[model samples]
Target chain A: MSGDLTARSGGLTLPRIGDRALWSFVGRRIGHAVLVLFCVATVSFFLVRISGDPVRQMLPPDATAAQETALRAQLGLDQPLLGQYVSYMTGLLHLDLGQSLFFHRPAFDVIAERLPATVTLAAGALVVVLVVAIPAGVVSALRRGTATDTTVMAAVLVGQSAPAFFVGILLILVFAVNLQMLPASGMGGIENLVLPAVTLGLYSIAMVARLLRSSLVDVLGEDYIRTARAKGLTGWRIVTAHGLRNASLPVVTVVGLEIGNLLGGAILTEQVFAWPGVGRLTVEAVTYRDYPLMQATVMFLATVFVVVNLLVDLSYAALDPRVRLS
Target chain B: MPVLEVNDLHAEFRLDTGTVRAVNGVSFSVEPGQTLAVVGESGSGKTATALSILRLHPTPPCVYTGGEIVAGGRDLLTLPEREMRQVRGNEIAMIFQDPMTSLNPVKTVGAQIVESLRRHRSLPRGEARARAVEALREVGIAHPEARAGQYPHQLSGGMRQRVMIAMALACRPKLLIADEPTTALDVTVQAQIMELMADLQDRFGMAIVLITHDLGVVAQVADKVLVMYAGRPVEAAGADDLFERPRMPYTRALLESMPRPDVPGGAVLDPIRGAPPNLLDLPSGCAFHPRCGFARPECASTVPALEEKAPGHAAACVLTDDDLPGTSEGRRVSGT
Candidate 1:
């Protein structure tokens, strides 16, 4: 009987695909991400051009036709739409995003200068989300239906519903105006990053906590958890080793997506706090019709979004072996 | 002395609608190096009885109203949870029904086994890994070295079950509670796993409390049988005795229900008429009265205590030996 069972089950054995397949899988995902970025850039480039003319917005109302034409010629705006598009693509091929109309510098260089500030804020916000949300979510799940769970969930609900701008102002008023422990606006010391990061991260924290709580709560009820308990594992070990790893798969995906959201949505928080990040630069470029700067910033954000999603997919595959990249 | 003795165990589930008496006045003992099969249909409290021994049920919904689970002379029901942790997986290990869901998907089968070893034995990582591989090999897994690194999804149902058994027996636990371990596998696989378990039992010299609904499984692996009906053991007897001379009506009905290959073609299989009684609203007196073919007027109003019909075979029923159909004619009489 044992021999028959083994012989039959041997046919059901999974073929062990080697590391080469894993590498190819990652490579294929990267290729897909790049293709998505190209589509984003193409759509945004034409869409932004159709909205209005940057030359008109940059020039004074009293300018003569000659001056306008010369300015347009110099900015290469006088060229046909197809001609302009061709040049834009050519410039992109050479890693050039054209010169900014407002800053009178290369659009890439202008955006690059502000990139660090946005990255810092996003990174800080991610830290806050991880440090605060994971523990809160785990506790809420472990102590499900208790007073602690109720209180934490209620707080998360409020945090998720509240607007970023509203939260930013509130934090400034309390931590900046009332107590004066930290600066309300600008980028300088670690204290300066606190308000904006918290304001921007509050929603993400809430989202992560909610997602993790539900995922973990569901995981805790799984048969494996009971098995873990039956194995004489301590409650803490079972939760951390067995439960948390499975629960973290969804959380990782959410956090990766949230990074893109944090970068794009940082515009409002940056404006409120006067943090000179790419988000604020993008807004300024739009107001002044600095087409190159605006296009470059939006494109940069799109690339980041696609790349983050790719990373999330890779991490997800790593966490769950059942997820085949193919 | 018995390796584990469960005395008058009363377990309930406190639900919003009402209390459910999942296991009521259940008592049994598993002696060293012996196999005690607790057989019952679904919702008959076999699982509840098994889990209650380890205190594995979630607290809010499940509560042990009364019982004494004496294992190694300590009452497990009243033992501190901290100490209970020591007994579980160390003194008395358990393997559940579905091997697919019972093992953690994220963890390697090797790591899982190693974890139990390290926890109980305090073995270092290097030694634990070696022992984990040895355990996998002992369960007849091919390529124990490579298999240890693979996740649960990589293994077939039979192999996964073997891994589960490997983990359970890795610590050399005195009493192993297997709750329908072969129910999730194919017929051939079930036979293989059962054979593997019996082999492991001989080598380890550990008592096994095999909880399953399959009479065939009980007949093959069990030395003694405790037939449960509606959260109570209706009959307790040596395996051959129970099969040869089933005293309780429910037990007789169960035996007749088994599909016999010897029966001529086109003959219909005899199945129990009604479902097991709902734990929340069980009938007064004998819970099987509604379904018992030999149910007497007294059976409906007064419960029959499990009493010795012979020297060691006990059954709970209102019928006497004269009232029961003889062993040779039992199947035909019950079917009609």
Candidate 2:
């Protein structure tokens, strides 16, 4: 113990990635990831089944018994419940999501075709959120209990309470209908991206700004911040370099979850804008009663959420040294 | 002339709930190469007084109502923030009490120290790093370079304190305000840290303002001691005289309350009676009168101004010359 202590005191080094500790962490994450997959599958299976009859939806209105039976057998839908579940799990392990019921294409291909659009839209919105929210949060916190501060906080409150769909409609009414300055909605080009991005990002801006402001308020009162001030670092320097940097963890944590939410819930905005995205594809599947398509889309969204949350957890160790990695 | 002179300083905080008189018309000074220990429990305005020197107190919430904090021949209260920045860390540096939370946990200890050095002096990063290592070594951190890379939580409580001391001394400030620097550590670590501070102070020839509630620490490091009660100075004297003959009742009570190691384990420790008065609803006359066994009728009517009871000892109590009995008499009065 004494020797180990002396060695540790002398110098510290990062542990090897392949070490037991690292492997254990990875193993734990993998276990959690498996559980998440199981949950997604269970929920998706029940949700799609309860939506309507997959068999009737897949078949034509005039199809005969032999034709229906042959189609069911071909799709493995004729299998017993346990057999179907095992087959689905096996397909998942092999990264094979079979053909979409509505699109008449592989589910993987359908999701792949639409994922980039959702990712791009969500990423754009997140960038807008950070660019707008961070400075606003810092400035508001710095100018606490003043007119400017009040104005900023009121804006945040309004943004938080206002729905994204309503904001999207308002943006369209102003930008597209009245001013004719930009496209009302869609993910066609940079010109079309502005309104929807802002609409999707507005609530995030409000949430992140509020979070950051409160975080900065608490952090600025900390002894280290006092020490920084005592060192004669200017107010701007203190806010930007110290206060905001420390306050960003909560913001970062929420950003990941928000991004997942945006990706999943961008259906309304996508519909309003006619953006060719996964959210729109999911909605189309729901309307058509496409069980395979809906299952595949939902499963993908769940995976994104789980992966994002995992990344956020990993970032906790990155942002705060006090969080013991071991 | 004193290196630092605070004359009748009054700092108040207009909290949303109500106004809190943190430092109510208190004053003290520290000469060059001397240690003045401002001893008080939490919320007794000791920390506020230190903050007022740098004008670090946030406005609106913390208002410096009246008085002069003249340090390095300039009134700190009136200095422009830009110039005050130059004075802070360059002339007057502060070490906070909680080492665990004092240093930025995200940044390496070296980065924080070097940041202070870089801000004050136009040193290259390499030179700044060297100075940081030297400062760390001065604070008795073994393998300073290696320790510098490690984060605050990686280090022990004592080590983090050394980092704080290193950071405080990095700029080579004329006065170092150590606000309860060793209060969070274990006894042995506290002794080690105290010794380190004293050793560094001697080497640097910097005056220290040691703000603490520990009388033991006050005895060890202070050249002069300022005892505060309810946001007011109860006693101020040379260290030896204050310890030998604590003039004020509050000081006497505080001294009596400390558990001495020399005393046997079975000896019942005497804690001071009554909690510290709420600053908002402080006692009418002397704040300590409620807790002071030696309170006279006059103590409840008129506030006692801090007056010289002896050549160097000043106490804020109405006790007459003979009322403060001799050491033997004091023991008899306490029935020791």
Candidate 3:
């Protein structure tokens, strides 16, 4: 311990990325993936069952009796509940999610096609969030109790309290309707993406920024900042290199949850903007009661949320050396 | 010439509740290559005095009501922020207690050191990194290269403190304020840290302000000792003189409380009878009167300012100057 405190007090060395640790990390992630899939399947199974009479909703109102009977038989909706559950579970095991009652297409096929669009929109929104949030959080923390800190925190408060949809409309009124700077709503192209992404991402930006600001403020008061300052590190280096990184662990969870939420929506923004995405498809499926299609889409989203949460957990250990996965 | 001079230093903390007079009218000086140990308990204002030198206290909450802190022939109290920033890590560095929390957990120890190097000196990343590794080696870290890549949490409590010291000394500051630097470490580690600090001071010829509550540490590291009580300096003398013949009753009480290594089973851990006086509502006259065994009616009414009891020695006590020093001053023995 005596030698430990004095040794390596000053030193810089290139990091050797651990090959062994990488393999173990991947193995753990695989385990998490399996668990998330199981959880998603279990939840979707119950939800799909609880939703009332898909066959009645699917059949045309003026259909003949024979045609109605044929459609129920084809969907296996005519079977007993236990038999249907067994059939559904069996189909789930084979990864055959069945056909959409309304779309007349394989449920998995439609979901797969729409996944990339949601991924793109969510990623863009995440990028926007990081670009604005991280620096604002860091600066606010470093300049705590000052004018900048007050303004940033107040802005975050307003952003958090105001509904995203309302804020989105407000933004459209300003940037789209009045200024004519950006499109109102849509993921038509890269240019059309700005409004929706910003509208959807703004709330997350506020949450992450505030979370980061408070955490960083607490960290700045820590003895290490004092030690770093004592070492002649300027405010910028201390805030960015030392303060921000340490404060980001808590912010990671908020970011992950927001990513899941944005992926779930932005469909409204997408529909309003004519952006072709999973959220738009999910909304359409829900309206038409396309049983298999809605189930697959909802399950896929649940899976994504679970996976993102797992990733956040892994990052906690990455950001903080004190955290170790058991 | 003295490397640091503090004259009539007064610091007050203006919290939401009330203003706390942390450091009140204290004065001391330290010659180059010497260590001045300011000994006091928590809330005794030793740290406030150290911070006042750099004007590091946050405003509205902490106000240096009055003082002149001259370091290296310049009044530090009035230096501009930019100049003060330059002086802080370059001229006068500090190592705080709780080394575990004092280092940025996210940054690699090496990077933190390099930051100090780059800011104070014009050096590219590679050169700075190289010096950082060399400094780590100098500080006695094993596998300096490997350890440099590790973050603060990667290292143990002791290792972090070493990093702190390395960073503080990276610029070779003229004065090093080690505020309870070893208080958080274990006994064995404390000894090693002290030896390392002494060695570094000898090599660099830097003046040191060793603020600690531990008298044992004072005996080991301090050239001169200033014992503070209720935000005031109660005694100041050469370490040898103060240890040999403590004039102030508080100093005597403090020495008695320390467990001596020489005595088998040690002196009966004679605790000072009462708590330190409240800064907001301090006792009239001598603040030590409440706790002092020798307190009299005269001691309560009249304040005793620090006065020379011998060459290069001063203590704040009216009895020290009395002609009839030993008799009927009614020395209340312990446990009475």
Span of 10 residues, lowest total lDDT, candidate 3 chain B: B327-336
Runs off by more than 4 Å, candidate 3: A1-22, A142-151, A173-181, A271-274, B264-266, B321-336
| lDDT by residue for model 2 (B1-336), tens | 787999999999998678888887788989889999998777788988888888888897888999999987889889888999998888899988889898877777887888888899979877887898888888889888788777787899999999998988888888999888888899889989899988898899999999999887788788999988878888899987787788887887777777665555414567888898888788889988888888888888898899999898898988866897664123211111
lDDT by residue for model 3 over A1-326, one digit each (tens)? 12122333332221226746545775787787777777777677667667666677767788788987898898878888678767776887898877888878889988888777778888888898899888888778868889999998888778767766687788889988999988876556787778777766777888889899899888877777777666656677777777777777788888878888888866666675556788889888877777777778877787777777777766676666556554
lDDT of each: 0.88, 0.82, 0.79
Clashing pairs in model 2, backbone N/Cα/C closer than 3 A: A185-A273
DockQ of each: 0.40, 0.41, 0.40
lDDT of 1 by residue, A1-326 (tens): 01122222112223236766677877887888778867876787788887788778878889898988999999888889888888887888788988898899999999889999999999999999999899999999999999999999899889888988899999999999999999989999999999999889988988999899999999999999999999889999999998998899899999999998997779998999999999999899889888888789888888888888887877787777677767
Q: Candidate 1: which stretches are off by over 4 Å? A: A1-18, B263-267, B328-336
Q: Report the number of the highest-TM-score candidate.
A: 1
Residue by residue across B1-336, what tens digits does model 3's lDDT show? Answer: 998999989889887777788888999999999999999877788988887777767676888888799887788888876677888888999988898788776667887788888889878888888888788877778888787777777787777788888888888888999989999998889888998899999999999999999888888778899999888898999987777778888888887777755565455587899887777788898988989988888888998988898999998898754632443121212211
The lDDT ranking, best first, is 1, 2, 3
Task: Return the lDDT, model 1, position A27.
Answer: 85
